[model samples]
Target: MPTRPLTCTQCQPKLLAYVHNQLADSDRRRVARHLNDCPVCYAAYLAQREVAQELAGTIPSIGLPDSLQLNRMWLAIQSDMNRPRTIPRPQLARMGVACLVFVLALLLPWSLDKQQVALAVPPPPRAPVVTASLNVTASPESGRRALPPTAAASSTEAVIPAAKTPDTPSNVQDTR
Candidate 1:
């Protein structure tokens, strides 16, 4: 199991100063020994030093500002940092239009018409013929011509022949 290191809140302010290289040699030595034994303090010291170095680089390196100039600089830095960055509405609208045009470029060919369907003359209707006789047979023994299966259904008729036994001779005998 791992153990948590003791954090000295009182030491943090001096640690910050020490990390920034603004502390005396005696205080630096004390903080260094404390950091060697305490992993939390060591990490905090390293992080604070890195932040101090980054902040020092970001701000101008001029001499300390007098009261009024310092106030104005702090105010300006705060206001500028706090203000939300925005893409203007007109620019967003223009980008939307550009995207629409690009999509249309890809889709225009599919939507446009090149081939037109010509109008064709309709064929004349066929004349109906009359049948004077109707006859149907039901028994397989009947020699009447067999109608196709698609013929209109009648309660007494069947178009298909009955199943034959396996041993029965076929109608056409093979000569081969």
Candidate 2:
């Protein structure tokens, strides 16, 4: 009995197996029949066969070298395989630098936040005693009282003295 005509899709998969003579007799016969009847399938089979033949011809057989040479090559390969691999010094240095930068990147914002917190919080309300001593004074001659000379000299006033202009002499009388 004659089999139904096989489509190109059905025949394409079996082509490689057929070219290599790897298919069962029944399947090979079916594919062979299809190739005989279908020009497109035949062309595809021919192309596949040509590629297989060319590949077989072009690829050199890899036979083992002489035993001594093969043994030496294997020993060299084995020694290479066994040797410990280490990162190059320059690459390790780069990695160390990268790690340092990454750690700094992670910590920078936190340090900045700590500084901001320090700035944001008003210094423990200057101890009332210190504030009172700084603000109130015994001198009544000048309606505006002044801190004791010692306290004034010891405070920030000592660090940054008020600038006196050249025209304004030190002996100038207070008009206030």
Candidate 3:
């Protein structure tokens, strides 16, 4: 049989088709003859055929598990079913006390008149102190120039007042 010659580029397209038995017999023979003579086409045909066969053999056929949705639903149900039902007793008591205090605070002013409640706090009690006396006398000559008196009792008990300058004598005049 006389064969029509084709380029490597042209033969490549029909190469797989020829191997898979999809091409017309004359076309297949032409491609097959080219593949046998050309190393590049022959390698490409083998790789393509091997890949096609491998892919056909390896495609997944089994379905995913059906329990996935059921597991998710069960978890959700368990979470909802097992949620905490009651607050701790102490917390509940504290909440009740707070509510009561709030209500009392709100109602207290309305229930009491200005005169009924006094806001003034009582002053704290004064601390007690002990007082003792001792007699002391300044010398008569210097007595007339006596120092001021203070709370601190004496040589025996002299109470010397804090120092304050005497007012200017009325008779003194500013000469400046």
Candidate 4:
């Protein structure tokens, strides 16, 4: 069929490479005699052989693992490909700050500080607690006379006008 017959626009592009036998034997005999005389290239070669038999039964293959689950997945990938390789958190914090600066440079000359460290002497000033309150005058016939802290701190001043503050509502009465 080759010597030149093709056309349902060249056998609709050689019907999916002639339904996967990838064409060549002289363009698969001119696309199998133009899919035996073109009913639209034989319904485009039965829709490219039902999409190459639904893509060769849509994939799903991987089945191997049985020898005791392939020897426990090859002993978990050969113990994760033979272990030991850690050290890197910035080289383990620069080897713990170079072993704390080589144990503080070998205890810096036996912790040197030959002189300066005797600061502990503060204990003297404590005397001002002089609380004196006197001018006691409430006297329903002298029922309460008590005012003597050296006569209420050597008394003298006396003009009481208005001093109230327990949130302001006391029976205030020193009208002088």
Candidate 5:
């Protein structure tokens, strides 16, 4: 894709990426070119570089591991180096057994639950039918006021007014 040239806004964010050499070849080149052309972005890049340098200088150095620990690590490394690339027969067998046991553990309960299933649960009894009279003296601006808030909240037979059809006379307001 033909990317648009980087503006100050775009270049500002990538200064850190440019400073750290984290930008891709094309992106790095673009950012480097932008830095040269734009003094403001170049200043930002310089600031980022300075901050990186300061951080590098102040980082507390870690002391090397002790000789015994180093020797143990070397021995472990050497042992791994001498070992065959493919899995050993005995270890592979043990791993296979472990995986089989895990699969059985997972599947056993599911299989048992399926075969020895409990009686099916019955659905709850249907809700009692409710009837209430609602006086909806509502306008478009006022909206519908079907009974007081307390009465409407408990009632199940709350009726929503249907939209006006084109056949309805404009003079006769729908009370439904």
Candidate 6:
């Protein structure tokens, strides 16, 4: 009598063993029959076989050296591990620079306060001075009469009155 065909779940676990020829003859035959009839199981079996073949072919077998040489190498490594490590000069210099920067960063704000106090003296009092000098001469070609110096000065002062009384509006008129 023909046995019932194996499902993909049953076939999956045996694929690696099937590829490696490690499955029992009866199980191998059953798995082979299932793979032939089932496309999913066949594809899975092919993938597993490909991966196994690739891994077996790509990996190199490592052989150990004699125990005497292995022991010597291990002792040498142990000695190196046990030895104290000293910081190199360049590494110490870098650490010193980093510490100096940290100290300066901590003290910078405090140092700034002292300099700010020294610079906080009030400026000297002086009379307000007008930088612009207004000349009231008329253009000779235009032949227009110019205002007297006193009237021009009063008009100019009116244009820019003192800042003490801000509410007072200047009565300057545009003469152009």
Looking at candidate 6, the ten consecutive residues that score lowest on lDDT are 153-162
lDDT tens per residue, model 1, 48-158: 888878887887455656889889999999999999988578988999999999999999866753221111222234444433445554567787667744434334322
lDDT of 3 by residue, 1-89 (tens): 66578789999988778767999888877887888799999999999989878876786333544587779999999998999877678
Regions more than 4 Å wrong, model 2: 62-176
TM-score of each: 0.30, 0.35, 0.33, 0.21, 0.35, 0.35
User: lDDT, candidate 2, residue 45?
Assistant: 90
Give the Å error, residue 155, model 1.
Answer: 99
Candidate 2 lDDT over 79-104, as tens digits, reads 99999877578978999999999999
Which of candidates 2 and 5 is the stronger one according to lDDT?
2
Clashing pairs in 4: none
Native-vs-model 2 lDDT? 0.72
- lDDT (C-alpha) at residue 53 in model 6: 77
Per-residue lDDT of 92 in model 3: 83
Candidate 2 C-alpha error for residue 16, in Å: 0.7
Count of steric clashes across candidates, in order: 0, 0, 7, 0, 0, 0
**TM-score quality measure for candidate 6:** 0.35
Clashing pairs in 1: none
lDDT of 5 by residue, 49-164 (tens): 99989987787344545789789999999999998878568988999999999999998866754212321222234444466555554455666554443324343534443334
lDDT of each: 0.63, 0.72, 0.69, 0.66, 0.70, 0.72
**What RMSD does each model have against the real structure?**
21.6, 16.4, 17.8, 19.5, 32.4, 17.2
Model 6's number of clashes is 0
Query: Against the hidden true structure, what lDDT does model 1 obtain?
Result: 0.63
Looking at model 2, residue 70 earns an lDDT score of 83
